[model samples]
Target: MATMCLLNICLVLLFSTEIYSLDCKMLHLQQNKVNMKSLELLSKMGGQFPLQCLNENRNVGFLQKVLRPTESQKENAKLIILEIFQQIFNIFSKNLTQAAWDRSFIQSFQNGLYQQIEQLEKCLHSERENEIPYLGNEKILFPLLKLKKYFERIGDFLKEKQYSLCAWETIRWEMERCLLFVDQLTERLQN
Candidate 1:
């Protein structure tokens, strides 16, 4: 009897995850407009990054390799996207206010990004705080590791530039690319 009850619980979880997944996919589809607005606001905030920073550098293309098309396990991709957003959110939290960049704009940008993060978190399950999610699966772990380095390199760049306006500007460009990929991944989530 207990085994049958356990099976029923598992089935319910499976169905709920699917329903949540559908909602998450739709959420991303709807988010494109909102994300474009945020990006436009960011551009208004700063775009005068230094010339050297604009030199088609190595780090700019790291994301393409890391966030490839969704494979058999769309959930893994979702988790990676979640991790990516969390990392960017942290970067913004730590450095955005340092330069006194337009107070209202900053608040609005953070709020929009925070809302998206919350929506994604609502639909996904993982013990993603300290440890990596899906640890044993090399396929899943690979992208997570690559993205970790990508965000870390962004940190390194910011530190090298003393987190100046130009540095934040470059980071803004990078963040835009990350969100675009997030959109792609969310669209590719299984129906």
Candidate 2:
């Protein structure tokens, strides 16, 4: 009887340890997935923004002439921002199954993102100065600024390790709002 009890206790301990380890691994994987999804969404914005700019067919020639001098700077900023996003995505992709949680890395990346947003904003503002009086610059700038805010919120949640469903839904809502503006702007530009 004593021997049987001892065996059962050992078995239970062994099984519990295995289960705990498995749970930890699963949690790590979930975290990685969330991070990767966020990065992918951010990267998509880079392409979407330029496409929106190009969709302004009527302003293409005039705006081009006005922006030609600083065009390279604008493009360079967008490319750099996109590259950074891709780099982060690649890192997350490579270690999808592992938990490479580094607070410093996330902080640095967030700061870089903010810097890029500022740079882009400045470029847009400069272009706005030469925009035709009737063209409402707010249509573009407002959505961009809103997207930046959403990114900041997402980054904060990521840094705090808060991946709640509600948080993600809120981010999604913000994204949709920005996209709606983009669609509206595209329509306006088309007309």
Candidate 3:
């Protein structure tokens, strides 16, 4: 009878261990899926913005004339910012493993993002008063600011060692917000 009781207890412990391992694996997989989807969305949105900006100005003869003097500089700044986004997306795509969420990696990413934000701020500051109407009335600035804030939150997560889906979700939300604003501005410009 004691032997049977010992056998049952052993089996129960083994089964419970297996179940716990399976649960952890599933959670990790879910987190990975969320990260990939978020990164992909960010990549698409980041790539779209520069193209949309270029397209919006294709037929704007009046606006072009007004912005002619500073056009190249403005466009170059936008392209630089776009390149930063592309680089960030590349990093996220390639480093899809759990190590990517490590403190060192997150710190490096945060620094790069902050640099890009500074460049963007400079670009926005350089815009002349007359360029405001053509640039969607400074609608782009808000999204960029919000994105920086979200990145900071991600940095916080890293510092806390809390690599939850919440950080990625926040980033995804900010990216969507930026994309929506850009899309609306593009539509307005097109019309």
lDDT of 2 at 108: 34
Candidate 3 lDDT tens digits, 95-158:
2333323333343333334333443344445554456443363444443444445445445543
Off by over 4 Å in 2: 1-100, 132-191
lDDT of 1 by residue, 16-66 (tens): 435445555465554564466567656655645557556534354557665
Q: What range of 10 consecutive residues in model 2 has the weakest lDDT sum? A: 58-67
For each candidate, give its TM-score against the true structure: 0.69, 0.26, 0.27
- List lDDT for all candidates, in order: 0.65, 0.35, 0.37
Q: Please name the candidate that would achieve the greatest lDDT relative to the true structure.
A: 1
RMSD of candidate 1 to true structure, Å? 12.1
Residue 105 in candidate 3, Cα distance off native in Å: 22
Backbone steric clashes in candidate 3, count: 0
**Tens digits of lDDT, candidate 2, 1-191:** 64564355345434543443343223223223333434444444232333322332221112122222232233232322333333333333332122223333333334333333344344445545766632254543443343344445445644443443333333333433432332222232222
